[model samples]
Target: MKQVFKRPESLIDVPAHFCPGCHHGIIHRLVAEQIDQFGLRDKTIGVASVGCSVFMYDYFDVDVLESPHGRAAAVATGVKRSRPDNFVFTYQGDGDLAAIGTAEIIHCANRGENVTVIFVNNTVFGMTGGQMAPTTMPGQVTTTTPFGREVATAGYPIKMTEILVHPTIS
Candidate 1:
C-alpha cells in the first residue's frame, strides 16, 4: 500500500486568504478536486461576488470572473451560455446568495441553467462586519440584530435549495 498527499492540480499552491478556522479553504479544495477529477481545469470558470468568496480567484488555478454584489449566479448564467463547452460555477456567501442574489439564483435555477452554485450559508455576513443575513436563523444575534432576529419582523430564514426545488410556488 502507498500513501501520498498532494494538492489538487486545479488549486493554486498558496496560502488561502480566508480567516483562521474558515471552511472556505476546505470547500475550495473540494471544488478544485472536482475540477481536477473531471479534467475540467482548463475549461472551468468560477464566478465570485462581493463577499469573502470573491477571493476564490486567488485560490483556484482556473479562470475566475468577479461580479458585483449578489450577481454571481447571473454572471455564471451568461458565462455558461456564452461558453457552452466550459463548466461554470459560482462561489457565494449567505449575504450574497440568499439576500441580494435571491432573484438571480431563483431565476437561474428555474431556467435550468447548466451551472453549479456553491452557496455558503454561514448565517452572518462574515465579510461585512458580522451583520445579519437572510440565511441567519431566527433568534440569531448579530451586529445588525443585537436583540436576536425577530421572526415577526424578519420572517424566517430563506431556504434557497428548497425554494429552487419546488416546481410551483404556492
Candidate 2:
C-alpha cells in the first residue's frame, strides 16, 4: 500500500482536544493548508480569542497573539494597523465574537479593517460547558437555558454575516 504522509510544512501535529464531530479541527487544517499554499507562514499573524481555541497558538507554527475574551478584533486591529504588510486574521467562537465582542466586531467591520475574521458559530458556548450563546437557536436547550431558549426574552439569534453585510456597514 502506498503510504500517505502529512504535509511537510503543515504546522498541526496529531492529537487534538476538540470534541467528537467538532469542526474546529477541520477549520484549523484548512487555515494551515492555506497558509502553506500561499507561502504565508512567515507573513501571517493569527490572533486567537478566548474560549476553546485559546490554545490555538500552540497548534499553529506561525506567530500568534493571545487576546482576552471578546477582544480578538481589537488586538487584530492593532496588529494589522501596525504591520500592514503582514496578513492578519482572528479565530473567534460564537461566545467570544457574537456575545461578548459584538461591539468590537461591528466597529471593526464598519471601519473596514484590513483583516480577516473566522467566526465559528456553533450555536452554544463550548468552553463554558455549553451554555446558550447569542447564536443559539430559538428552541435549543443549553446548560444555561434548560427549558429551551425563549425568543421573547432572549431575542433572536444575531446573524453576524447579515449584520456585516449591511450596505452601510460593508
Best by lDDT: 1
Model 2: per-residue Cα lDDT over 1-170, one tens digit each = 88685752657565787889888877888888888988989899999998887767878888999996899999999999999999999999999999899988988988889999989899999988999999999989999989999999998998998988772622
Model 2 misplacement above 4 A: 1-8, 167-170
Please give the distance, in angstroms, between residue 59's alpha carbon in candidate 2 and its true position after superposition.
0.9
Task: Go through the candidates in order and give the C-alpha RMSD of each one to the true structure.
Answer: 1.7, 1.9
lDDT (Cα, tens digit) per residue for candidate 1, span 1-170: 67598899998889776788898999988888889999999999999887887888899999999996888888998999999999999999988988888889888988889999988778989888899998888999999999999999999988888988873665
For model 1, state the Cα shift of residue 90 in Å: 0.7
Q: Candidate 1, after superposition: displacement of residue 43 in Å?
A: 0.7
Q: Candidate 1: where are CA atoms >4 Å away?
A: 1-3, 167-170
